[model samples]
Target: MKHVRLLILLSLAGPAAGAEGGPLVLTDLAGAYAPGSLPAGGGWLALECGPAGCALRSTRLQLSRKTVLHLDEFRVPLEIPRVKGSPLALLHGLALSPGPVTRWHGAGKDVDRVADQLRRRGRWTVPGDARQLALSWVRLPEQGGFRYHLGDGTTRQFLFATAFEGHYGGDTTPRVRWAGDLDGDGRADLLLSLPDDNCGFDDRLYLSSLAGPGQLVGLAARFAGRYPACGC
Candidate 1:
């Protein structure tokens, strides 16, 4: 198997941390992998941003004579073998305005609140065991949403769809982070941050369990009326 290296290049005007003390604002986010090694039909996945949000966009990829894949909003699972001297390479890039930093904080009472809302809204059902919860990030044209896999590891569900007021209705991007094990449930949890309708960011906490159902809670109330340092 051939190993691949990743290179990230980011250009910003100010320090990642602003004088006001907030998340580092990134003026430019761009990078490439195996720059000139990919085949002629291969190209880097570029980031597209507008009123909607930022997402990875790229043309289709011709993996082989019999394999052609479209890199659209839908997810395509592919398993590529390491062929010595192969010309295939992976690349990606992104750019965002300077703003407060966003990250996952972990599972907690707030996550439980979100989970309750999901149940009330008929979006999700509490699993029998908290330890069965699983979390992952997903992108879709209608709005970026998170994926929750039940303990069975095969059952999956969408948690929520986020859209900013002025952005394209279906182009919202979802940003999720792993927060390790929280709530002392012996299960892993997640943290999500997405652009809200007001153009500000909304933060949510989620806890996954192996012995119980999953829980999601929102932390926006804690910063009521206060705009997140970062904007959509």
Candidate 2:
């Protein structure tokens, strides 16, 4: 029970919770893994498959420096492979040629609209061939006010953020820290910072290849950077 509880704490640890700062951790919003690296001199790899963190020696893949672990499991690879970890942001499936990055702090009267900002920039591309990724912040008129639709696009629009609540509504502000082809699908994949007054620091990864029947992209993973109020 103590081990299980310790694992849970590790998953949710943040600056406020006495967590020692290291590289930024990217996790499957729905998968199992841990945020730890092997000893400094290129040692064996271990994967904390569960909260218990019962790591089995898996096949090792050569890496240049410290990295986040990726393993097939004990039976498959003799060791787990690690990718260079980042304290700011990290995501899998991202191909070269990083996408254009944009930021919006958010507000009521300021109105330095994110939509207008991207439109003014004109072009945000990914990879050498450079395919244009559609980006928009569509506002639809509603009964009381306008509803917001924000996302990227290819043939169809891929929404990562939306707002129906009025000006006073408590909605998390969506900030796009980076955008690119993480899935290599020639469509835009986004890494967004969605922070709430109560929810703490939350980063999300969206991939075009994982989209369901109607979505242009689907949430593939997440990294909870910090949490001050404890998520219930």
lDDT string, candidate 1, 51-145, tens digits: 34323334333332212222322222221222222111112221222222222222335445554444344233233334354434333455344
Off by over 4 Å in 1: 1-152, 164-171, 196-198, 209-232
The backbone clash count of each candidate, in order, is 23, 10
Q: How much lDDT does each candidate structure score?
A: 0.31, 0.39
TM-score to native of every candidate shown: 0.29, 0.39
The superposed Cα distance between candidate 2 and the true structure at residue 178, in angstroms, equals 1.6
User: What TM-score would candidate 1 get against the native?
Assistant: 0.29
Cα shift from native, residue 100, model 2 (Å) = 17
Q: For model 2, where is the 10-residue window of minimal lDDT?
A: 72-81
- The predictions' CA RMSDs to the true structure, in order, are 18.8, 14.2
